[model samples]
Target: MSKFDSLYIAAKEKLLAAKNIAMVTHINPDGDCTGAALAVRKLLLALGKDADIYNEQGFPSFMEFLRGDAVFNRYTQEDGVEYDLTVFIDCGNIDRAGKVAWVCEKSDFIINIDHHSTNPMFGDINIVDSTASASGLLIYDFFKACGVEITLEVANFLYVAIMMDTGNFSYSNTDKRTHDVAGDLLELGVDPSVLTQKILRSTTYNKLKLTAMAIDTLHMYCDGKIAVIHASKAMYNATGTDSSDSEGFVGMIRDIKDVGFAVFLRDTTDGKLVKVSIRSNLDVDVSKIAAEYNGGGHYSAAGCSIEGKIPDVEEIIVKRLSEEL
Candidate 1:
């Protein structure tokens, strides 16, 4: 067994010993975090334990296609809820859990499962493997080690998790093992053609409007090396969309040839915070830039949340990216 297998054994032992379990993912949950958390919850349930997922921000609108939407409890700091183990999936640190961090602290045992290199390893059992293309990949390995059968439902969850995190296998993180795992999932009844349509091609009319608004704000800086876009509250209101609708806007700008990096900034539901997503070409390590703002992710894709006016935030980010280039 590899190191992850041993950790999986320990995780399995902990789950079997526990009665109530809470699986928590990071704030502004993405497909990787949501899918990993939900998949693990199902596996825990199969072991005859009570398990549920807690996410501070619920699923993005585009990810409604994934399974287990209702089971996610939007964290509200309610009292009297308890758990023996709290598994943090795809979160680099406890703070990334946002409002759910309190629950993680209250839990008797904590398990941190993630693929980010900057993870702080702040759990009783830390399964932090940066080499894994996605956290769901680690969860898949965990399921295999526990001898849990990969049902069609479970297979779809892991499939979406891996596919989204690897950027449909177009990202550098997608390697031989990633493809092999995807092939296994395909054999288990995951239809790539249908999944691709739902995840990539399918979009709401509101999302298209939001994309247009964001593109209108696009500005290239550092002599076209950096492409930046900003979304404001007015745009959200006009487009009948939220931050989630602008999911792929950064990637849209990233496709521009000769643009070394792309940036997307949007006002949070609470106007106090601006969420920044960064994507980079081969020339830059965007994770380092995100880390400077107390965010973390893969080298090619990363994000951070900043407290400032959107314009100021955009200017500061361009300055930072300029330094990086």
Candidate 2:
């Protein structure tokens, strides 16, 4: 029996009692959050309930393969409707829901599901396991508790959920159970190579151009213990790309030889906000650093956003991170 069995039962009870369900994802939805959201929709449907996913930022084009022909329902800051329940998937904080946070206030019940180490337990029934590599794993466990079979459709979404957050099973979070669940997905005929090609190998030329530009700002700090990069608004303008195009830039820095920590500062297109992404390959907990800025994530990868000039934000984050190193 898993330690989360009781929590799963409580979540199931709330979900079972609900009539209309609203599934919400965090800002800048990623595979883990999006995948978990989709699975919840499928589960609600399987149980003969109505479920709708509300993502304020919409889905990423790179993740289109996961959705296939399905179109995600977008939350456009409307408040006329009310839901019996709203489930937050992969969101560490209610604020992470961005514009759609209004749903939480209107919903009769709230269920927060996540795996972030900094989660504050914001849900009426918070199903959070900081030790779990991905929130998709929690959804997987919930399905088991409900006696729901791991269908192929659910498997595809869940697989990518684990794969993305775990960096394709190569990150430190991948463990025996992670692999065991991935193996089960493989048995369901999920072609990993095909998905990998669709995700990592299918980058556009503009994205590469943005990467080249971000790489140009690379600098070392803390005697090469910390590596940093930035995608300025000018760089995005020159590359014809936006903040979304800067994905995976921090990981590239973290992979640098002998670099223990990596930070990527992205100046939003409007130039009024700078989003900070951090990753670490050593004992440093980057999430703790991110928390100081009101961001939350796992130890290996975390992020926060500051509303200020890129130069100022960069200096602020670098100095804080330096203290940790």
Candidate 3:
């Protein structure tokens, strides 16, 4: 058996022993994080355990279609309520858990479940697999191992998580195992057509306009091998679009012919912080660049947040990425 199998077996026992459980994911949660948390919550509930999901910031509107309303909670430090166990899903490190890190610290036991190579092994028990495309995949395995039934809602959420992180099964992370897991989820009655239309096709007019504007600013570097776009707070305000609307804008640049790398920089709500998402098509490892800013993710697709003006952050990224060209 794999090392992760042993860890999962041990963690499952601890989880089964805990009655009151709390689940958390990283800040600014994406599909994988939310899916993993929600899947685990469903499994725990199936096992007659009480599980609560927590995250500081809310998810994007697209994710609202998932089962988040009842189970998902915003973190607030309460005096008297302490969970017997805290489970972290898809978080690379304790710090990535944001406010929930304190809750993890105070809990009687901690469980970390993730697929990131950079996971810090912060929990009393950890089940991390760098080869998995998404944490939802691991959660699926957990549910199967524990003989938990996979409901339609669970299947849909896990499908979204796997699909998004795998770039609709087109990214380098897509292996035969990823496809097999996705097929299993499909067997559980996940409607991919509905999910695709809802996630990829259903965008507001304002989002479309903002995306066009962002694409207009796309600049080619290194003889058309790299493309970059910057969206300042002013641009977002002028377009009347939230930061979440800028999601997938980087892919527009990456789609360009002969482009090996693409970068998108946008100022966050704080206006002082810029968020960067990088995508590469070839031998370039964007995660290394993201890690320079203390961020961690996959090799081809990675992101980092910078405390600087968009132009300044763009310049630094472009200068560093130009070496790869």
Candidate 4:
């Protein structure tokens, strides 16, 4: 049996006892978080139970095509509801649920599902496997434990989760088992060509314009080992864009040849803080740097936020990366 088998069994027991379930993910829901939540909902629905998916901030536009879009609600969209069980997926800590974390307090049990090494295990039952490629993969296991077949919808959602988190299987985390899982997903008829076109290729005009602006702001330091990109509020306003449009902007900087680490800073919508994304080629553990700013993620990719101007956050992060490099 796997090391997490016991945790999965415990989680299954809690889920079986609960008739009404509420699910949540981290604050800026990514494909892995979004997919895992939806897949879990699908599992619960198949079991003849009610599942409500919640997010403080709804998913990105590319994810709208996933199943259960109608049932996915923001905290404000609900009319003060409660649940027998609250399941938090792809979140490192309970606080990662943002405002909705308080709503979960009403639940009789909480299950934390994640694949981050920094996960705090803040739940009545925690199923955390830092070695797993994505939380959606863990949900895939959950489906197996429940003896549910992997439907096309479930496969599609898990495909998006695994693909995005693995950078389409190009990241370091893509191992033999990861590919094995992908192979199984392919058998369920998830077309990689169509998914890539819909996700990575289908960029909006405004997003492209924002990307151009972000590229112009790139700064290389530490003899070109550390690269930085900053997006100001004015840039977003001028380009008719928002934080969503800035997604994947950090990858462009990380792609710079000879750059060991890359950092992207964007002014938060409320303008009170700067959101920082870090990507590393090798040698540096960006997650550690992110943890210093109350953020955490994988070794090669991580994110955090800082209270200050974008320039200030950029300066501090660049300096830190410089010291590490």
How many residue pairs of model 4 clash at the backbone?
0
Better of 3 and 4 by lDDT: 4
lDDT by residue (tens digit), candidate 2, 77-130 = 674788889999999899898887888887998989899999999888888899
Candidate 4 per-residue lDDT over residues 102-218, each given as its tens digit: 757778888989998888788888888989898878988888877788998899999999998998899899988788888999999999898888887898888888898899998
Clashes of each: 0, 0, 0, 0
- Ranked candidates (lDDT, high to low): 1, 2, 4, 3
Candidate 4: worst 10 consecutive residues by lDDT?
Answer: 69-78
C-alpha positional error of residue 305 in candidate 2 after TM-score superposition, expressed in Å: 1.3
- Residue 87 in model 3: lDDT: 91
How much RMSD separates candidate 4 from the native structure? Answer: 1.8
lDDT values for all models = 0.85, 0.85, 0.82, 0.84
Quote the lDDT for 145 in model 1. 94
The sequence of per-residue lDDT tens digits that candidate 1 reaches over residues 125-162 is 99999888999889889989999998888888898899
Q: Write the per-residue lDDT of candidate 3 for residues 1-325, one digit (tens) a residue.
A: 3446677777778888887788888877778888777788788778778677788775556788786554567767878778788999998778777776777866998888888776778788888888999898898888777778899899988898898888889877899988998898889899899998888779888888888888888888889988999777777888898777887888888999999989999885545888898999988777778888987777788888888887788888889888888
RMSD of each: 1.6, 1.5, 2.0, 1.8
- In TM-score terms, candidate 2 sits at 0.95
Better of 1 and 3 by lDDT: 1
C-alpha lDDT of candidate 4 relative to the true structure: 0.84
Error of 2 at 296 (Å): 1.4
